[model samples]
Each structure stands twice: as C-alpha cells, then as structure tokens.
Target: MRIGLAPEVSAALRTDPGMLREVNEDAALAEYPSYLVADGMGGHEAGDEASRAAIEAFASVIRPGEVSTVRDVGIALEAAREAVGRVAANRVRGAGCTLTGAVLVQHEDQVCWLVLNVGDSRVYLHRGAELHQVTIDHSLRDEMIAGGAHLDALPGRNVITRALGSADTTADSWLLPVEDGSRLLICSDGLTTEVEDQELRAALTMGGQPEAVVEELVQRANEAGGHDNITVVVVDVLSGGAAWHVGVDSASGSLAESANEEDLTITATVPRRAR
Candidate 1:
C-alpha cells in the first residue's frame, strides 16, 4: 500500500498556526499505514500546544517499519489517552485536546483502516466515485441533527461534545476496510466546516495526486471563509498489495510522555459508524 500526506495553513495567516501532526508509531514488514489530525484546545497558542503534545505522545510509541495489528492499534490509542491524561493530571487546569486518527492494518485479502477520534475531526472514504464520511461528529451539530435540527439551520455552529484531553479515561475509535485504489481522508473541523463532503468528493474524485487534492481542499476552505485553522491528511491505497500481518500484545507502557495541563481556550471550531 502507498500513502501520502498534506498540511496547509490559513491563506491570511503566514504560518499554519494550527497544531497538527501525523506519525507511524511502530509496525513491521510494511510501512505504518496511519494518519492523524489533532485540533488544539487553547485559543491561538494554547490549543496548538495541546494538539502537539498529544500527537507527540501518540507518535513516540509505534515507530515506522514495525508490524501492527488491530489489537496493536487499540493498545497504541490507549497509550495516547493515558499520555493526555498524564498531561492534565500534572497541571491544575483542565488542559486537553481533540485527537482524530486512523491506522491501516492489513486484513485477509483487504486492509482494515482503524479510525479513532475524540472530537469533530473527520475521516472520509472516496471509493467508486462516492465520497462517504466514515466518522460522525461529536459536536452540538450532531446532537441537533439527532434531535431534529435541519442540516440547513446549523450554520457556523461550533461546539465540540467530546475531546481527548477533556477527560483522562476514554476516547472513541472505529475500524474500516479499504480496497485497492481507495482513498482515505482524515481532517480537522476547519476543512469540513468550510467545504462540505460533496465538494470534497468532487475534488478528490477529479483524479489527481494527493497534493492536488490537498490544494483544492485548502482553496475551497479559503474561498468559503478560512475562519479557523485548516488541516488535511490524505491516504491512497494502491494495487499489488496483500493483507497485513499483525500480532497481539498487551497495552502496558506502550506509550509514555509528560506535559503540564492548562485550560486552552477553544476560540475555534470543534462524532459514529455502521456495522
């Protein structure tokens, strides 16, 4: 399987102030097929730190070139949750972050994409000319949708119901299967709020390199408003690949890290699956 990644900053902002990172912790035989997007919690600065810290903790565990299984993915995520909790524990303030990530584990004759998120960041699959949002948003908009709010009414709504650092114990995750020529997308709320899924599908399905898709997504966000930080990660599975081999392991000290906790102001933007 082949993978690609792209990260961009706001058009007006000189730098991509948003704190976002992606890494392949540990896997063997094949390159780690995983992607992550962390939307910081603090205002401009603090939120950036929360996201960076969480990403670092998660990345340190599973380095590249190590074999990973579905069980390994779970253990790795648990380690990440612990790391975030430790950060909050040390500091008196409730310092936390939103983490959305996905790991590609080889399955029998196919690939299983494991998705884990603690906020509104999203994961999408573009297959057979259809762009489907795999993960649901854990925000007020979702709640409203469930409560009978029309899609057209929730404009620029910003309230995240769940996040990684907000609490210490649990987080949300999902698993998916991908076929050859399938494209997987993981992004922060910035991109989704600015550009709808239909637009995203249209751009990605145009048939270009990952970089092109990233560029188009960014452009669309800017055209829409570019209100908040925008981050996008794209992964495409190529042909001539087989199922990935995975081994089971216990989740103990698999992930380790430290940081102080502080309530980062979320002066920015902030979800489920089928069986």
Candidate 2:
C-alpha cells in the first residue's frame, strides 16, 4: 500500500501550561497524519508522567516515514493505556490522561482521516466557511446533557468520565474523506475551557498560516484568564504540488520547572509519497 500523507497535508502545533498552573501536564505530537494531544491529570509529577507515558507509547510504535492503519493506531493506543496504567500503579493518587487526535490513512486508494478521542479533548474540521467538531466528549456533563440535563444545572461539567490508564480506554474513532484546503485542529480542554466555539472558528478561518493561527489561539486563551494547560495542533490540507518534509519545533522545559515565559510551539510537515 502507498504510504505517507498526500502532498497537500501540512501541520503546526503549540502548547502552554497556562497562567495559573505551575506545571504543564499536557503533551502533544504533530507528525503528519498523526496529530495528537494528551492532557494529564493527577497530582504533582504523576500527571506529567501519565501524559508523557501515553504519548511515548504511540511514538514508539508509529514510524516516522510510514502510513499507519486503524489497527496499528489501536495497538498504539492500547500500549499507551498500559503505560499509563503502570504510572498509576506507582502513584497513590492514580494517574490518568485524555487522548485525542487524528491520523491520515489510505482507504480504498484514497486518503482519509481517522480521528480518535477519549475524554473531552477535541478534533475540529474547518472546511470553506464552516467549522465542525468531529469527536464527542466523554465527560459527565455530556452524559447529563444526553440524559436531558439542563446546561445551567450541571456544575461539574468538566469532570471527564473516560480517560487513558483506566480499565476503559476505548477511543471513539471516525474515518472522514479528505477535502483540499480543509483544516483540522486537535486541542486540549485548556484552549476550549477559555475560548468559545465561535471564537475558535473565527481564529481558524482567519486565513492566517497554521503557525500564526496556533500562536494566536494560545495567546487568546491566556488573555481570557488562562485557567488550565493549553495545547493546539493545526493541520492544513493543500493542493498537490508541495514536497513532503517534516519540521518540528518544540520548546524545552520541564513540568516541574516554572512555566516558560515563551509559548512552546512545535511544527512539522510531511511530504507526499513519491509515485
């Protein structure tokens, strides 16, 4: 089978611990066709460890220059769950993390996106002038809403009902057809917690480059009372012609250290497979 993203696919990413937090428990990956974000939860170092472990598991299994199948993605996530479970076993508080992202794959000789999510982290699609959320949140608030609970009555709306490192690590996935010029965004609740959906859509459709758009989004979240760790990955689908090359720019800082004064941005581009 042909491997690698179509010549048109390119992406940019950014992450921040937020204004109020001392440590950033969020981790993200922006490899072409494999964009992901993980939000760690627990206390102290456990949360950071959980998030790192989950992303590491996927990194180990997904090669840099290969196309991954749905089965491959599933196995990688299972490994991540096991790794997180190991982290939980070592901590009295029991660590966990949210996993959400998308991978590009070849389906019936056409390139399609396979989106996955566990917890409230989200995947959004911006096509033409419209924006769409691609994943359902696995949070108690969503459950209540589904059960006819009023939005005003749900005070614990942020409490997630599912995550990695627990017994239930079943991730919901969707395979979507590719549309040229479409943009995909994968982000943590940090960005969503502070920014409204309309705001996100406006930022995404503003016609800015992926790098600028992500930086602006993070900046906006911080300006809106940066209450949680924020992370964003933006993927741009272009028309065929550009060569495939991966560029990743990640900031170096520890969760234990004070939040970096500068935003941590990572960008990567994967070229299309040669015929």
Candidate 3:
C-alpha cells in the first residue's frame, strides 16, 4: 500500500444499551485522530467499568486535533490492558471487554489508519463502493472457522477467546491507506450480529455526513432485535493519504466481491463462499 499525506479526519459515535439490557456495557472514544468502541462483559456493572476504562486509556494517549504516532497508539493500548486488568481484579468472575477501532497514525513518513481489535468487534473499510472487514474476530467460532471447522458445527457463538481483562491482552493491528473518500466503521458485535454486511454497505452507501450515517446504523441494529449493547463509530477521511480505489479490476469496471484481509493490500479476487 502506498502512503501519502497526513489525513484530515472527522468522526461520529453512537451507542445504546439495547431493548433488553438495563445498563449499557459499551463505551467509545471519537475525537479526530482516535476512534474506537469497547464492548464490556461480566456482571454487576464491572463490564461497563472495564469498557470505560479501556476507552479512557486511549483517550488519554491521543490529542484531539494533533496527529499521533504509531508508538503513541502502542502506549495507549498497553495502558488499556492495564486499566482493564484492574477492573477485572475486582470481579470474582473476571470482567473484560472487546476493544476495536481505528486511529490516525504517522508511520515511516506515511499517514494511514492504524486499525486495531482485541475481540469480535470489527473495523470495516468502505471505499470504491466496496465494504471490507479490516479486523478479524478473536472469538471461538471465528477461530474455528479460520482453522477449517464449519461455522454451523460450532456449539456456541458468544465464547470470545480474547479481551481486555482476559488472559490475552494483545490486539491485532492493521495499516490501511487512507483514500480521500474512504470511510471506516468501527462497531461492536451487537451491530454485526443483527446487521448483515450487505445491509451495512447499503446504509453507508447512502448520502450523508458521518453523524447521520452512524445514527442510522445504530437504529438499524435496534430494529433488528438488538439482543446486546450496540455501538458504532464512523470515521471519514475528507482528505488524506494516497488516493486509490479498491477492488475494481482495471479491465472491467464491475466491483470485485472478495477482498484481502490476509495482507494490507486490498486486492480484488474470487467471491468468498459462505460456509
């Protein structure tokens, strides 16, 4: 991926406890260079505290208008791990939360989106009229599927293998080149479970600002049962980085279905068959 100029970004965040949950266990931080969402797990408000703590760690590392470095992001993530661990210490069952989001970072003289995730929460990129899941899930079902097991064969889908307060604190990170018109959607599992990728693409495809887009997506998840806490963070790059569209075969103008998450380069390939 080619790196370009520093990015000028705008972001919006929305979260709800959902229809069933009495307390919202989700927290987010969206201020220019930093954008993220955390989904807390555990009982008696510990989860909520864990999520908030994680977001606070990130918020402390980032300055609202100033550009941040990749090292700063690392510092923030490590801080979050420590903060969440403290929250978990107070709980008998162990409290934890899934952290996922994108941040603007200057790396090796290039500016890009440093997307990160610790659990099943996702970061999706929208560009060239195509939607790509930038972050992979750290959940049991997803891990099994990636290892060649069938998704339907998995006994349960909610068993996440990684989280802030869990044994695993390291998060997977990705560098996505910032296209001028590209948008990033950071969300918790609640939204992904209810809203299909196609539906999400459609909603994001509609014309509107970042705030309007995020609000509509949260509303969509609620309409679709809203079994858990829902959170959405939308980051738009009005201008930044090397400008390039994704998934369009130069030979044909048609959009390509398969996108590469295995590597940073988002290439067009064969369609992925659902298992």
Candidate 4:
C-alpha cells in the first residue's frame, strides 16, 4: 500500500519545566510497514529521558539502512522495554513510561497491521465514515467500562493500569488486516484525553492529507487544555500494490510548525515478515 505518514509531539504548558506533554516515537520497517508511539512517565526531565530512550532503542533497529521484519519489530520493542526497565531500575527512583506502536506486516496474500502497546496510548482505524479504536486501554476506567460502567462515569475514572518502565512490563498486541486506503491514527493520551472522539472522527473523516490531520489533532488537543504532552502520528495506506514495499528510508527533520507544533520523529521501512 502507498502509506503516507505525518506526526507531531508537544510538551505541556510552562508549568512543568522540561516535562513534555507526550513523547512521540515510531518505527517503519525496512521490509515491512510499521509504526510506533511511546508516552513516558517519570518526574519532569527523567520522564522525557525515559521516553526518548525507548524511542532510541527501537529506532536503532528501524533506522535508515537497517533490515527489519515483523519479528525484528517485536524483538526491537522487547529490547526497548528491557532497556527502559533497566534504566529506570538503576537511574531514577520510580520511573516508567507507556509504549504503543503499530506495524504493517505482509501475511499470505494480505497485509495486516499489528498494534502493540503497554498503556493508554491508542490505535484507531478510520474506515468508511467511522473511526474504530482497535486497541483497548489498560486502565481502571476501561476495565470498569468493559465490566459495564456508564459512559458518563468513564470521565476521570479510567486511569492507566499498565505502562512500560512502569510496574507492568507486558504489552498487549493486536493484529488487524490492512485494507487498501485504510488510515491508521496513533497518539499519546494527551491528544485523546482532551479531544472528543466525535471531533476526532470529523477530523479523520475530513479525508485531509496526513499533515493536515496532525495539525487539526494538535489544535484539538490544545483547545482541550493542552494539559499534557500531545503526540500524534497518522498513516494512510494509499494502495494495495505490493510493488510499494521496496525502497524505504528514514527522513530526519524537526516537526515543530508553531509554538504549539509538536516534535515529530518518523522512520519508514518495508521489509519481509520473518517466520
């Protein structure tokens, strides 16, 4: 598929010094299409470091000129988790982070996108006129809702139950088929917590380019309070042609477009899935 990507990452207000609202990280395999996002947790500077560390660990494998696979992606994530755990174990006094990511792997005659996560970060698929959040939140509110809680009661009730570098280390991953023209939106809690799903649906349904979608999503988050670091990555699968799998590269550049603009990091790859 022709996958076009756009991403953004922002810090919170001037309140918490050096404390980003969210940390944005992604991985695009060299032989397969993959994407990732990590939201960190630690006090101020420590939290930012933890998130950046996880991203660096994952990026090491999917960086330009590296050959990677579905298995490689998983291994890379595991390494990232382990590395973060070790760092938090030695460096900080109770430091952790949440990690969420997605990868497009080829399966038989179809391409499937896998969602991997350990916290409240999310993966949403925009199909037709509706947007479906494929990943479940590992939080108390989500659990209560799953166990039958009122929709209105969900506000301020759902709190993260699992996160990377946190007390929990296990990450739940889901596999979804990648159809032609499917659009995948992955973001940190900063964006989702503030922006309403209906508004999110409207923005994604606008069918704008990936760049424009990121802009709108950021704006929505800021309007919602910008209480935390906001990060978003939008990937649109343009075609089903297998020929698009060859020739992939990681483009490095600053993502900030304005004071509210976020820091965006993108790594693109197309590799064969290893059995």
Give the per-residue lDDT of model 2 (tens digit) for 1-275: 23344646778999998999988999999885588999996443488889989998987777665456655676677778889999999987689999999887554455567677888899887765567777778888888988998878885647788888765676776666566677888999999889988888889889489999999999999999999999999998776422221321111221221112322111121211111
Per-residue accuracy of model 3 over 1-275 as CA lDDT, tens digit each: 33545577778889998878898999998887888999997453489999999999879877778667666777788788889988889887888999998887776567766777889898888775578787777888888887899756885557888898988766777666677888888999889998999888888888478899989998999899988999998888886556674442211122122112122222223223111
Model 3, residue 54: what's the lDDT? 96
Each prediction's TM-score versus the true structure = 0.70, 0.83, 0.86, 0.71
Name the better of 1 and 3 by lDDT: 3
Model with the higher TM-score, candidate 1 or 4: 4
Per-residue CA lDDT of candidate 4, range 1-275, in tens? 32332122111111111134344332211123446666666352366667767777876655433223345556667677777777677763755677776765433344456566778887786765667776667888878877898887775623677876776666665545555465778887777778878888888889488778877787778876877777777877665523322222222223232112121222222221111
Whole-model Cα lDDT of every candidate shown, in order? 0.57, 0.75, 0.77, 0.59
Q: Any idea what lDDT model 1 has?
A: 0.57
| lDDT-better candidate, 2 vs 3 | 3
What's the ranking of the predictions by TM-score, best on top?
A: 3, 2, 4, 1
User: What is the number of backbone collisions in each predicted candidate, taken in the order shown?
Assistant: 17, 2, 0, 18
lDDT (tens digit, per residue) of candidate 1 on 152-208: 887444677777667433455444544556676777777877787778878878937
Higher-TM-score candidate of 1 and 2? 2
Candidate 3, which ten residues in sequence have the lowest lDDT sum?
250-259
True-vs-predicted CA distance for residue 177, candidate 3, Å: 0.7
Candidates in descending lDDT order? 3, 2, 4, 1
Clashes of 2: 2
Residue 249 local lDDT, model 2:
16
